[model samples]
Target chain A: MSGSARVLGVLGGMGPLAGATFMQRLTLLTPAERDQDHIPSILWSDPRVPDRTAARLAGGEDPLPWLLRGIAGLEAAGCGAIAIPCNTAHGWFEAMQEATSLPILHIVEAAADELLRLGITNGTVGLMATSGTLAMKLYQGRLAARGYECLVPAEEEMARLVMPAIELVKANRVADSYAPLAEIARRLVERGARAVVLGCTEIPLGIAAGPALPFPVADTIDALARASIAWAKPAG
Target chain B: MSGSARVLGVLGGMGPLAGATFMQRLTLLTPAERDQDHIPSILWSDPRVPDRTAARLAGGEDPLPWLLRGIAGLEAAGCGAIAIPCNTAHGWFEAMQEATSLPILHIVEAAADELLRLGITNGTVGLMATSGTLAMKLYQGRLAARGYECLVPAEEEMARLVMPAIELVKANRVADSYAPLAEIARRLVERGARAVVLGCTEIPLGIAAGPALPFPVADTIDALARASIAWAKPAG
Candidate 1:
């Protein structure tokens, strides 16, 4: 029917809150002056996808099939492209890409572009994400390729601070997540981090709950939103 | 694959911002303590659907076919039910319901339930909505079936206050929309309205831009969100 010519599909539900927030940000960040100017999108948020970290780190159930099913659903919905908001879920990025011909926007690349946009061109950028993401070096290898040194929380900090904060946000306890997340963020700054990349989709919401961070921070949700906008916009 | 058993389809994009906000409210309002506890949903937001007001009031292109296409897509994507957030768009509720076997949650019905929840069992309730929704009596007929007496803004008030405020919200000037909306809302209250139903999807966002209203208010976005949650929840 109408507006079906081009649609961006969002593969979400790694955690429902983060996925919904990504949709909201994508709508708000688009440079449209009217309703028609906004992007056409379909968000397929299924929260039952088994934990990405558990699948990646431990010998847990496979999530690739669930991810592929979502991609297939989005493709069947006539989406020209797809964007997945969850950072840990990106562990299946390559397999998902091969499963479908629709161009899937890369969240890590978007975060790297966001770092450049924030003028953190050549300094140590702190990363705050799930242990699965760190295990894969999703942000490390990409940011390093762009000439940026990346710093991540110590093992103890991730276990004590980062992971708990992420769980709080996922459990809908966003405000309670802010203190511990902000504490770890301050520790990163103390270690000479120029700025922090909120690498996980849920981390941005947790950090946003408290007072604004003194250090420059790039939210991966916002990064992915801008990337989605860029993909939706016609070339000049 | 994992959480795809019972997906809620949101037929949105009457105006992209309102639809996105509704999805966000749906996620936040759900009684979920964790990600998997939240509902599985697919939001098909296509802003290019011909304006419902233009189509209904001015003999413009029929948006029914476009609406049907979205519904079909959601069905194909394995959505067990549907929820359309826009009040004006709900003018086609019966036809949409006829088009699909999936149970579509009614925004007006949800608003009626919200009124009872807010202790407005028997009083004049003001309505703030698009002229198309007003013309179609989406709220008037439905709420009249209940005990509530409905009041609507006069023609001039809709033209000057309500309509422009809705446009400002769609155009993303949310903060700028608060004054005129509040003014008309105040006038409605002066005429003995116990509470106001923010009938149009965009109206809630416009009204939410400023300070909280001193009077009771019900937002259809939140109402629809609750309805979706109720549908997703297992029967006790």
Candidate 2:
């Protein structure tokens, strides 16, 4: 079997579109002049895995076992490392890593690192993600650890704006999601957030470019894609 | 490790976007109300596999070994069946099937089946693909076996329209590709093509849905995605 210099495994299908978005980002991010120069990847898009937010909030089945199986599949396919694009899934990150020796890139950690790299050291970073991600402090804890304050949607805003918006995206009503999500971004900026992190994978799809949302948006999937590329770089 | 009832392995990334598009179509085509109802898939998007067109035409490095490795990776990941999205890569379909005992879905055969289902048994089916696919008679031979005549781009059209359009798509200038490709589609319809198969994965990305081109367009990726879903259905 002729593997590339390195192969990055993608643990995805938290929602199938999000997984596809991650793969598309990988293609867009790479400096490949030709198709053959792009990264080699093995992706396990098993949408059969239980929903992470529902599993955490409503006494649904644990997604860990299914996630572990995905990791195993990637490993079996000879992936050197793995990356999961979903932010809410990181609630079980430690357990998934424990299940396998393969180095798994954390989405929140990658986003936080990207924020610091962009020189946003001391500002309030806004996070717009699934309720489960916010409830578990997925981005909050990671940003706080790096000495950055985090701002999130208020409880009412979450119920009224963020969560429903994510649902709309999952249901393939992406255009309908824009207004509510844009309002959430506006409120976050008003609450003194210097930049916003699209903590949920589907969030980026809803929000479009050009002066609509008046802050720098850091897409977590884009950060993870870059991290995967760096991780796949051959050792010196 | 837990595998789904049936895992369809994707041998992809002859061009990265095409592979992602195939995965997206699988998600779209399934009769799933929730995520878990969708099929599970393992994908090896190894763009590092040498170009199939260059190999066939100009005596470049054979992509067969890299392709075989991808197949092995899929089998190791416990895939019961496999699909390759690239039309040009179908040239090595038999060789890959010989390398693995797992059932592999053929994109050309799936498209041919779709043509019959559409009730276009005796008319000329137009094909728009890379020079390599055209040269190998990839679609022509399969459609002919099924008693359908295949009409490819004329040599002048291949050089002037089809080949350059595919390159523009590969270069991410999809919008620029639309006009030329639509012209080619117009010419094919004028030549008595009852339906046109977007034989190249990149072709569908170029043409838009509107009254510009009037022929029935059968997207090969869509046919392959449906075939994969059928292949993964649990036996009664």
Task: Evaluate candidate 1 by giving its C-alpha RMSD to the native, one decimal.
Answer: 1.5
List the candidate 1 regions with Cα displacement exceeding 4 Å. Answer: A1-4, B1-4
Which candidate tops lDDT? 1
**Which one wins on DockQ?**
1
lDDT tens per residue, model 2, B1-236: 24547888898887887888888788767766556766778778988888889999999999999889888888887788999999999999889999999998999988887777677776687888999999998888778878878888889999999888887766666678898899988888889899998999888878852344666888888889989988877441
List ranges where model 2 is wrong by over 4 Å.
A116-121, A208-214, A233-236, B1-4, B116-121, B208-214, B233-236
lDDT of 2 by residue, A43-138 (tens): 788887888888888888889988888888788767888899899999999998898898999998899877876778767978899989988888
CAPRI class assigned to model 2: medium
Residue B207 of model 2, lDDT score: 85
Tens digits of per-residue lDDT for model 1 on B1-236? 23435678999887888887887788778766777777888888998888888888899899888899999988877889999988888888899999999999999999999988888887799999998999998888789889888999999999988998898887788889999999999999999999999999888888887889999898999999988888888561
